[model samples]
Target: MRARALVGAALLAACSSVTPPGLVLDVGRTCEDIALAIADPDVLPGWKIHAAALARSDEDPAWYLASDNPDELALRRVPEDMPGVDLSALGGPHEFTLTRGPIEGQVWLTLDREDEARLWRVDEAGETMLAGPQLTGFPADTSTGWIRRLVFLGQSPHLIALPRTTRVGEVPVHMAAVSPELALGERWTLTAEVSCAPLSELNCPLLWEDLRTLTVLDVAEPGSVAGAALLVSIASLGEQPDPQMPPMFQTHIISLTVQRDPSAERPLLTRRDHVAWSTDGPVLPSPAQIAADPLGIYVLAGLVPAPDSSGANATTADYLFRADVLGAGTSGDSGVIALLGKDLRSHLLQLGSRVAIGQRTGDWWHVAPIEGVTIEEGIVGSLEVGDRVTLLRAGRGQVVVVGDAKPSRRVRIACADPDDGSETGGL
Candidate 1:
């Protein structure tokens, strides 16, 4: 009986995209059960009554829960309190069947062959299905030859093909195990490095072994290229070349293809060195941390002193620049670069459009503008080793600098907000 009901429900769900305006269900309600009830109302004569109770049980003043009683609770049903279910898990509820009920009483179910995960709706019309849990499975290993690398292109509720597979004109396949937490109209790409074994050890000896690159594409449409953001890049470092040597290692660069306009000549933008090693050793950056920001991605490459190197021993003049990502494919020298700061090793903070640089000479600590020029003198007062300094932008073009001084430590130049005009102070 359950088998027949499941099949019938599946057929009904496949046949229609619209659900009646007053049905509702819980977050984890089985589709097979709902289908049997929906297809033949007699199967569950009091299903609507149970749905109403469930709706009222989960009602909150913040949102309107679906319910059978429009006057008492309104025409919506409360969502069921199903543990371990998340809206992000449902993949936006595109393929589920919708039913309405109690104040928050809407229900949805997945037709996916893998799991019994179900989606819930807040309304009976099924126009808005809530998210559920993601199904899982091992993706088929379809490497015709030794796999070199894999890149992620775009993610959707539907399955996606691996980047290398797509390149070879193979049918796009998906790794059913990983489902991203994405919004509607948002896209993602994942690039994976399968292996880094040297092709030839006799002629060209490779320094590092077991290297890989993974690049992710968050947005791909041509019209949205500039707004497109990189989620993250993950790379694994090869073992240290020499245990006694100063961290020698090789890096595998992951490139991204930024899609421009569909009709434009060459809608793809590729960047090499998008992923690089730190000065210490070859280690890939974390993709989870990289994807957290929506504007741009940054990979820290350690500090480099200015070429002059004068006063470098006492005080180094280092400039921080964005790592070159164009690799060898760039032409005409128009590439991305970060700003330069005079003294960054001591105090370094990058927030929005401003960067804070701090320095201590004798008793006083001084700060300078990251961009424009400023004139300020040294060590007016003393400060303790662990004193905290906070700088706030003063009104009317004025700069406010605050210093928390420690005992026995005189006020040195605590903070510096460089104004266009000459400003001098002693604490």
Candidate 2:
């Protein structure tokens, strides 16, 4: 019965562009399950998928896959029927998506240009709705390309264009929000210096962070978006590399919440809250897709194993990882959790909360939470040293469960009062 239900969910996701909230995971599911659920359906081999937008055709809710080929770009409707417009003239689409707007679905696209960060809104047939007056203060870098992402905020409808770093190691620390009307000459300031030398393999510094995905929720007003989340990937040099082999890169994940101050001349985007996991060794964590629910944020990612002592590579492990956003007070008795290995894939380490299911090659451990440890039960636990854990949410009275399977042994997630400096030992 469970297998049948899983298949139905996968089929529904494949047929629709919208990601389901409860599709994060269940017991006995792996990370690849979520990855495949959110992955784009197979398009023609040459075309690179740029974005997935809501289909403009119906009220029932469907999606269109926008892809780019060497010659031009096109939108292929899901379930494969409706013919879409040929967008060859858009000039190599950077970021494009359809958002709920003045009418219903507005197709927005950003162009690949050096002087200006171009924003274009077109119809389902690819005819322009509004086009002009490039976003001001866009970096004019000829050697490198800039990537942009767009999202709609509230009923008053403010369109936000977020900039990706022009080069690796350079984090674009600023964001902009434009009203429904495409106001001209908006400016952005750079908070960090671009130090990455893409060509120089050995000398270029490795510590870097890049934005992966963005989600907005609980919009109080056109200017006040309460829970705007950004999934970021942070990379650093794992181990000193041999002169011959390329350096091993260790990647980590970060969930950042930014607040918008609408009162500023140009609405300022500032960090409000963040959850990060400091891990040991070099594990290449690649988060391909991310989304959120009322509970927390979830990421479908590929975690590549660090190179062994022999310097040989291993297959990447796909897993779905969750970060607690809502506190236990609202989420009820217990929340989903899982225990993952330090090496990305191996024997399970200290049982931790948050659901993380890996590839088939790893053992799925079963464990139970020790009750009466705290009012939140064993949900709020102390993070162990060298374990990939994020205790940042515990300060907010959040509890995360570690394992999903019905197991015999008892495992306790220690509790710590962030304010009082009080902690209970793990069992």
Candidate 3:
């Protein structure tokens, strides 16, 4: 580990060529023109440019930022002499969070408006059509219920809305909803709690359980859209041993399955929520992230209690669990396949057969394995075989292979031990 860290530090020192704050371009260039220009390999190789008009600025040639390190960012500019595209506008009136679709060259957008939130599908020509139900009266801020997470499966987008607590008379009541099994390009009905599945009750007292993050594990019979499974993490207030002490919280993970409704025509969907498994104590920290694979589900969270003092922060670790063995409030951490170190960061990615874990210390970046996988030792940032780690700056999705910046980077991992030389189970 020490040797690998040292090599990573050296590479970090060598890759500090670009240094600036904002991207200044020719006066006539629109954001669309810049996006098209960046796509050309001759202009910007390996880097992805997400084009959108600056929220606060309506002028041409908006500002853009880049970074040698994800944390130590710098705004760089395009030379002022380049030609510009003759586009009329950069974006529409409404603001939205853009994400890459499951298929290549496809894009999904979530319009964030004050009165409601809606999903749309954007074609290559930049035309958009409604993809899912509009979340009416959803407060865009953290003060009220909002769209927490969005997962795309085989062209279907599932939305999980965050829970909102409100006072019913004098008692606090929780309310939450979702748009499940959304088949894009099809006419679908939109209801407040229709997608909550078996818990679709209008007054289902979601109680203190606040939805955090979720990921779809498997779509049983995806060809027919027969059924699907997902893992959801919920957080609730923990017992207060001392009334004056700061409130504590516990996170719980549950498995939800949705199947085609037999009674309804046109393959309507129905779901059932169950406690597929449980871990002892408060293992998961608040606002944990979950992702699914063939082996099982992996959660990225703090393995240790958070620091009580203010102004102190620490990175979380990644834990992989078996999907088959988990069931009925299982006790202990027996399901855990691996427990990564605290120094490792979240956002685990399946590059080839192995699950990659990213770590950044100061200017250096390291990619390591978190499960039954093996990566070449001393490998930093990019892989030894030229599989470089780059952020997919074009969308809100996880890291993809290339040289753009999002939250983390990606690399491939081998599923066999170099010493014994046998194939092992991996994610």
* lDDT per residue as tens, model 2, 47-157: 454443332323222333345447777654444444455667655544344332323445444443434555555444443356546664444444334444453433332
Deviation of model 1 at 64, angstroms: 20
Higher-scoring candidate on lDDT, 1 or 2: 2
Ranking by TM-score: 2, 3, 1
Off by over 4 Å in 1: 1-129, 132-139, 142-209, 213-228, 231-247, 250-255, 258-269, 281-336, 339-427
In angstroms, give how far residue 119 of model 2 lies from its true place. Answer: 2.4
lDDT score at residue 253, model 2, on the 0-100 scale: 42
Regarding lDDT, does 1 or 3 come out ahead? Answer: 3
- State the lDDT of candidate 1 residue by residue for 1-427, as single tens digits: 0111101101101223333231112232211111100111121112121111112222321122212232232222222233223223333322222221212333222323222333233333333435544333223343421111112223213223332222211122232222333212223334322222357434221233333333332222111113222333434433466778764433333333342346843233444334333334333321111110122222222223224332322212222222222233222111223222333223332212223233443334444322211111121112223335432221111122333442111111222223313233333
lDDT of each: 0.27, 0.34, 0.33
Pitting candidate 2 against candidate 3, the one with the higher TM-score is: 2
Tens digit per residue, CA lDDT, model 3, 180-298: 42332322232112122365456442432333333222222111122334344444434567888754544434443332445854222222232222222333342234343344334
